[model samples]
Target: MDYVFTVRRVSKGAFKDEPGSTYFLKVPEDADDISPDQKVGAAGAGMPDKWAKEVLAAARSGENPRTVQPKGDILIYVHGFNTPTTTMLKRHRLIRAGLEREGFEGVVVSFDWPSASSALNYLEDRSDAKQTARLLVDAGISAFAARQTPDCEINLHILAHSMGAYVVREAFDDADDRPAVASTSWSVSQILFVSGDVSASSMSDGNPKSSSLYRHCVRLTNYSNPFDAALSLSNIKRVGVSPRVGRIGLPVNRPDKAVNVDTGAYYERNEDRFRDIPNASHTWYFFDQNFYTDVFQTLRGDVDRNRISTRAGTRSELELHVA
Candidate 1:
């Protein structure tokens, strides 16, 4: 049984008929050109039951014949604010490509939520988007567990960016409430929050040990750059506080009980490259090769002493107007 990858768009309210988005297994070199609407599974259709069955069987038996080399479970990605549907698809594809480039062989799923392609629309859909994310997470976890593959370990890794970070957090926080959704006692291996805007207060409001959010997560890695201007703007607009990746703030070694990854040093090392790329401030984590490499390494629990850097640094200059 090989890991089956699927990508699809889920829309809310009145916009349901607009070609329900594309989700498919990512291929090399052509990530940017693939549309979320393009079907990748059987018959050039949508997500097929056969693929789901294969995934469930593999999860139960721990044998995935589809992959070149048997690997762990799956990795799901959720994109951020002001991102169009096509852009989200491309980003997810690129992420899968990057992971493959690093020799990872596992199913990759991209959960696409409706975004209005405007800052105000992005803000308006935040809550609804979070709800969507919660549904997908629950479904993915349950689908894998119910079909348990005897020899394989079904682990889930989530990589969310900006506002998508909020979605991931909310899903984890609400996992226990959704009993209808499949439950996974297996801890989440790693949660990578890339330039996330979520506040520390919200993250720490509930008890660390008792909270549903903290119980499921093992290592929480936040990729935050002090030089990320968009994050600064988000901080001012949302909670009037500074941005902290992985919800860990500055002047403190850690945030209450969350693990933090300082991205300031990485930014400093690649300042020239970031500055050269237009609109690169908000997307440094994905755009920078070194940043992606470091994150991939961190998720694998392979700590390179050279990659560890400052957990806190000065905020970037505010460039985007958040009116």
Candidate 2:
């Protein structure tokens, strides 16, 4: 039997529902409930308390109802552009299942910001990501970090894919301490940026607009691929922006805080599995066993880059390769 899927969703999309004996509700992408548009519109939001009382509490619950504490970490997943809530839930479940299969002992929460599920709505999705960024930070990341424990600290890891990277980047507002603790007083352990859709130089050192991202996490790992088709569209559309971190990897001038791990070979090694996924290179990471193994090692948090067989780069950067 599979473990019960536990996902605390924080959505920024407006909800449509009728009050009755049974609830019938839906969150449409646009106000018209027809065509998608590029606008920052949000209906309502959720989380922080429920997350603390239920999801976070699962870590210690003797019953272990959701199997949240077996691994000792909280892995929050933020979905990327043009994703529907149902697809978001499925992806989150897939991630948790993969992690469990790979010996990860923890819980996975999906932060579902409203993204219309059609490529035509790319602009709309971008608007939604920016709108939901703060909610993800204040209600999602902050709430989990504030959870307390006596014996062991709850490790936090963020596995953000594609355009979701922008949301994660924008969400790091208050966390600013020795290793980027939130103003609410907590630190993220590892941020696993799988195919981040943000500009290559966004997180580089001295980029005043995005400096906080460099300070907070013990480590920032970028999982990149030169062949990400989805990000290819992003690059073409957003002409001025440098190549996405998902495509060309981060620039050499990036802060010493971030490390780039190239996984292009992993896709070549698992071409059949890549083809199995709808979008292949872009979505393959979710289905790839190699990806699950690497993510498992990252969450384990004991290995260093040098010992992991890394190559030195122009700056103080390391290119970590996963066999």
Candidate 3:
């Protein structure tokens, strides 16, 4: 089976002469051969011409035309609250571009969930985006598993930031309940939640027997900061408790269930600065170069490279900086 890959550019803010965001698609790679425009624009295909043109243009310019085979391990990224489709694309491209700059190999996918520009909309979408995220994960996993070759070991990793972590958690949970999906021969190596806002109670609610999270993925890591302003506000407005990763009252010893990366040091250093709205404290995990270097090391499975000592009892800090 052949797969088609394309890269789409979207505008998160105003649609101007130059678009602000870009995202790549990892289809069969052979998808380049068939013009989505032709298929979608044909009288019977039923898709709008505008949509077809956009997709065709994206597919044609997404990657290096000369590059033949798919790149390294596959990584799927889901962005968090208040993110527009264009911002999601641009952020993914930035991450991919950075990884390539660091000499990493792999196909990076951005799972764009609909986010409205308004704060209220973002909040509502954050609550409702899990279903869409599940679909994205299922589609990506099924597509990759179906096409994987025996000689090549394909590793799937999910990296979700902030509210995006909620989507990942929900998707993983949902996948676990479906035996046909959960029992697949393919495995998800790791799930990295950066500044996740999910509550510990939500994670611990059901009996271990019925929990899909522990059953489905090999590892789950939560990176958190007690000082994350958005998360703090979210806690007050929504869940009543500070988000899971940075909750101050949790036990000093690591929970037997999930891997937690204490980000007290990072938070302590940048707390005052991240309190503002536009600053988006959580995003620093991806945008800052030094921060991203630590994230890269963690993704490469070199947790020690970027270790930080924290009062939270010497927890691994790299886990908090997912790309």
Candidate 4:
């Protein structure tokens, strides 16, 4: 079963593009096999707390009974703009499927905030993304942080894609203002951004805009593809914004813990294989096995950044190798 924690309002048995109270859901991979009447109801109030306990317990106990790995991590996937709830869940399953194919045993969860599922609604989605950012902090991150034990062997991580990067940055900013310990003191292990949609300058070493993000994560890895047409300079949706870190790598003054990996070389060489995919440059990572290999290594937290086989060059300027 895949876990989903959504903040999208339900309308006529489907998720609509409007913010709503947070709810936790457990969806089996074969959910299509079951009728709508057989579907379970959403968890009730205090559900986030219970959900966190269940997730932490599962993470603490290895999913595979014979494996003795001391640690298991949960990766909270935050999707980009223009994605409906169905597409969001599909991506969650694809991510989990890719990770499992590489022998990953940890759980994958999603934080699905409302996104106006239209290509023309970029500005509208951005507004909703900002409005819903606090929900990610209050319900997702803080909930898990409160339940984590002092000696906990499990790690929590985040993988934000495209505009989801904006959501994450804003979520940390919102959490910074909260007086509660869970909100202010929470941290994650690895924070990865694929096709990040935030401005490059905002994440530079000394920029106050991302100060809270820098303070909270142990490491931040950005996967940039210069060929991403969706984030290119000509994209009208970003008319007045500066260059994106997802299209152009991080600014020269990036934080000490931040690393940029240019995936352009690999993508260009493999572009033919992805020609059928819409906006392949920006969305191809999840569909590539080699990409998942790199993600798996990153989440394992043992391999040095420069030593990962799927990448080449120094840690400061790595290039994703073509598989």
Candidate 5:
């Protein structure tokens, strides 16, 4: 069963009133164009508190030994920009099914932000994504942290794709900027950044943007590929850009905190990746089942980073080439 709790970020007027489908959104091309999306019966359709509460409850339930409990981890997935609202729901179910097929016992919670879904609206989407960061941290992470009693041992894992990495990073930034709302003690067990679209230096040494994030997460894994076309465009499209973490890899300086898994070798070995415009390499995490197996091992956090695969590149930058 798909155990997904949806949080609609777009305003009510921006969403179509669908009976069966709960989420339907209009693309936000201009900041002033669309109304803010919210709850079912909210004034002007304010955002719902139920889904966030539901996610917290699910995570809490996973820790209950007295009640029916799950044997594995709890995942909170945040998708990148330009993703349509309806497609996001499908992706949630797809992820749950895929994880189960790959021997992972877990439930997934998807945090849906209002993305314009238009490649041309990159600026608009970026603005919207950054602002949504606080919502994820406050409503999702903070609330979850508050619910934990002295004996709660639920494992929390995070998976972010593409621009979703931006969201995660910005959330930490938001926490640092606004400490009153930030839950400093909410330590994430593991985080996987799949083809992240953030600046490569953001997570490096002395970069305060990542200080809170790295401090909060026990382990962070960056699934990178040099052949990611989407991030290549991201570098050129954005002003004052550095090499992206997803395209190149994380800085070697923070090896203890973040491990860069270079999946580029897999792409070079598999020539059939060019069937799509963006290339199959970018989406391999979802398309390949073995990747999920690797992810399962990653969640364990006990395997040595070097022992997992052959290490490539210099000591300043390490890349794991896993089959």
Candidate 6:
């Protein structure tokens, strides 16, 4: 079973965009059981308080006692825009499988915000993303951080994709505005962005737009792909918005802890294999073994950034080397 923390409203046996109470659900991995129209109600869900504790316990315990690093990690996955309930569930399963194949022993939890399945609801989705951003803090990250005692063996991390990056940025900024949340020692280890939809300039050093995100995470690794057509479309759709960090890479004045990995070359080399796939360049990282290998190493955080085997170049600017 996989964990799903959803904020989408249930209506007529389906998940809708309207706001609703959040649920902490333990869903099965069976593809036959999970469908876009299925009503995931009280039967599969746990009490909010109980599930939060369960997540923390899993994070603190090692999956394998024999491993040198006995401590565990928790990766909170915030998915991209235009993802339906079924797609979100499938991707959650895929992430766990992919990471396991690469020998990752950590737990993967998904934060499912209400994103419309239609391709034309970009503006609507962005608005919802901003509206729901705070829940990611209040119900997800902050809840975990508040419960974690000092010297805890677990590591908390976030892996956000596409417009999910915008949600993360807004969430951190909103959290900083609240005195209650700001006073807490809530922080994460690694903040990874895959095909992030936020602007490059906003992530630069000294930028007020993302200062809170920079302050909270130990490291920020952005996986950029110049060939991401979806982000290019996002740029165009936003009416001449600044270039996205996922497509144009980080700014020259990026934060000290921020690192950029240009995956364009590797994606370009393997583009043909994904020719028939939808949003291939933008979403291909989920299907790539090398990408998982790099992510596993990153989540481990034991190897030096410059020493990660699947990468080349300096810490500031690196190229993903296909294995």
Q: Per-residue CA lDDT of candidate 1, range 1-323, in tens?
A: 11223223444422231223334443334444333334345422444565565544432324446553334646778777777755776677667667667655555666655555666654566755654655545445545545545555556777888888877777766667766542444456777777776765555535442266566776666565667776664543555454445333322434443555555655666668777664576775666555555555655555532343322322221111111
Tens-digit lDDT track for model 6 on 1-323? 67778777776766687556676777766652232332244532433666766666666555345454447789999988998877777777778888889887678999888898876888889989998888888878877766665455678899999998998999999999999989988889999999999999999999999999999999999999998888884554667777899999999898779999999999998899888777898889887889988998999887988889899999767999975
- Candidate 2 lDDT tens digits, 127-228: 767766766666566656655554445677789998989888877743342243343565688898888989887767787546766666888888888878
| Per-prediction backbone clash count | 15, 6, 10, 0, 7, 0
When sorted by TM-score, best at the front, the candidate numbers are: 4, 6, 5, 2, 1, 3
Ten-residue stretch with the least lDDT total in model 4: 32-41
Model 5 steric clash pairs: 10-37, 11-36, 11-37, 12-37, 38-46, 38-47, 39-46
Question: Model 6 residue 272 lDDT?
Answer: 93
- Which 10-residue window in model 6 sums to the lowest lDDT? 32-41
Candidate 2 stretches greater than 4 Å from native: 1-51, 60-71, 174-183, 233-236, 308-323
Backbone clashes in candidate 6 total: 0
Of the two candidates 2 and 5, the one with more favorable TM-score, higher being better, is: 5
Q: Record all residue pairs in model 6 with backbone atoms less than 3 Å apart, i.e. clashing.
A: none
What stretches of model 5 exceed 4 Å from their correct place?
1-72, 233-236, 271-279, 309-323
Alpha-carbon local distance difference test for all models? 0.55, 0.64, 0.53, 0.83, 0.66, 0.82
What would the per-residue lDDT of candidate 3 be over residues 1-323, giving only the tens digit for each residue?
11212222234522222122222223343332222232222222222334323332332322333454332356678777777645665667667667667655665666655555555565567555754555544555554555555444556677788677777767766776679876775556667777675665555525442166556566666667665666664543555453465343123343344566666665566656555636455566665554555445555664533353222334433333223
Residue-level lDDT tens digits of model 4 in 1-323: 76777777766766678887666776777863212222234433534555566677666635333444456789999999988777787788889989989888788988888887688999888998999898787777767876766456678899999999999999988788777743356789899999999999999997888988989899999999999999987887778888999999899889889999999999999999999987788899878999999998999867899988899999778999953
Worst-scoring 10-residue span by lDDT in model 2:
16-25
List of clashing residue pairs for candidate 2? 71-105, 174-183, 175-181, 175-182, 179-216, 180-216
TM-score per prediction, in order, is 0.71, 0.76, 0.67, 0.92, 0.78, 0.91
**What local lDDT score does residue 269 receive in model 5, on the 0 to 100 scale?**
70
Judge candidate 6 at residue 34 and give its lDDT.
36
Better of 1 and 5 by lDDT: 5
